[model samples]
Target: MPTIYLSPSLQPFNKYLTTGDEQYWMNLIADDMVPLLEQNGITVKRNTPGTTLGQAIRESNAGNYDLHLALHSNAGPVNLAGKLRGPDVYYYPYSSAGKRAAEIIADNLRKIYPDPDLVSTVATTKLAEITKTSAPAVLVEIAYHDNPQDEAWIRNNIPLIAQNLAMSVCEYLGQNCAL
Candidate 1:
């Protein structure tokens, strides 16, 4: 079975504009993905709540994982608050495998995100999760939590989001999964 390190956001302080925090929503999606991941013949290893990103990176690097998937919701900058929507799947600029994984995730995410045109795969040299792990990594900013419409969309579609994410992972792992 292909093993994946599933790191959901640990930032409970990044509250959504509506009623929840990034940590809460990200973990809910991660929690839901676990069973589906296992059923699809993938081994899932995840970071615990309250752990730091450094700790999660260390744990993932110590493991023999095929991929490292970090789940998070986005927030717009101060001046741009509530103006952005859609997912941004990020990967290290120099890693081909990471870029491919990120592209696959972004494409799959477009199937569910409100505007397919808004879903993008971003390449960056920063972001510890994308640079420090042993496995190919993709940190997906699932949606803009600071936007009311996006927050409402996320709150109402947890199951669909989870299933879509799981399908994305399965596809990345070369496993067949129907949405």
Candidate 2:
């Protein structure tokens, strides 16, 4: 079976606009995705909560996994906080596989997000989640948690978002198992 390193955000300090923190919500999504992945023939190696970002990266690096998927919710910079919205799936600029994963994830996200045009694949050189992992990686910022509308969307649609993401992960693994 294909294995993936599922690294949800470790940042509890990043709070959502309404009721939860990024760590809490991202983990909730990861929680929902695990069973779907397993049923589809994918093995999941997930990061432990309360661990540091460095630790999560090291755990993922130590594994012989096919992909590293980092789950997160966005929060814009000070001036733009509560303003920006949408999902940004980030991949390492030069890693074709990473880019492909990002595209697949973003494409599926677009189908469920209110503003399809806002979902995008971003190539980056800075984020350690994608750059430092051993496997081809894509870090998905599911939506802007700081934005009211986006926060409400996340709060209300956890199951739908989880299902969509699990489907994307399955597609990335070449499993595409409809379970």
Candidate 3:
């Protein structure tokens, strides 16, 4: 059986930000993906509190996981308090599989976010989650939390967001899923 790593973002402890803890959104995203993956006959090994995103992918790599997906919401220096929007799919640089998976996800997200241009791009050259994973890896920043509209969408469409992501993965792997 093929395994997939589901990693949600940990709480951000930055002092200047005023927003809900990100873990709640992460967990919701993880929960949303699990049933869909299971429905497609893909086994999921979720990352827990004790593990960093990179560690989870590495450990899963040592096992049987074919893919590693990290779920997150973005907040940027310019878009500080619910002001910026759009989803960004991040892939490990130089990995064909990672790029393919990101493109699939970007296509899926575009359907849901018809107004904005959803982008699939390479991660920052130094991010460990993309740089250190042995298996193909993609991290999805679903939307910019600093944008009120995006936050509202994140809050209201958790299931849709999760479903879109899972569908993309299944599509990339050519698995038939019921929903």
TM-score for each candidate, following the candidate numbering: 0.97, 0.98, 0.88
**Which of candidates 2 and 3 is the stronger one according to TM-score?**
2
Model 1: per-residue lDDT, tens digit, 1-179? 79999999999999988687999999999999999999878999999888999999999999999899999999999999999988899999988989999998888888888899999999988899999998999999999999998899888999899998899889888988654
Error of 2 at 83 (Å): 1.0
Task: Write the number of the candidate with greater lDDT, choosing between 1 and 3.
Answer: 1
- How far is 34's C-alpha from truth in model 1 (Å)? 0.3
Tens-digit lDDT track of model 2 for 1-179: 79999998999999886787999999999999999899888999999688998999999999999999999999899999888999999999999999989999999999999999999999999999989998999999999999999999988898899899899988888885976
Worst 10-residue stretch by lDDT in candidate 3? 12-21
Q: In lDDT terms, how accurate is model 2?
A: 0.92
Query: lDDT per residue, candidate 3, 38-93, as tens digits?
Result: 97899988877657655776676776668888888888775356565688888876
List the candidate 3 regions with Cα displacement exceeding 4 Å. 12-19, 78-81
Clashing residue pairs in candidate 3, if any?
82-146, 82-147, 82-148, 83-146, 83-147
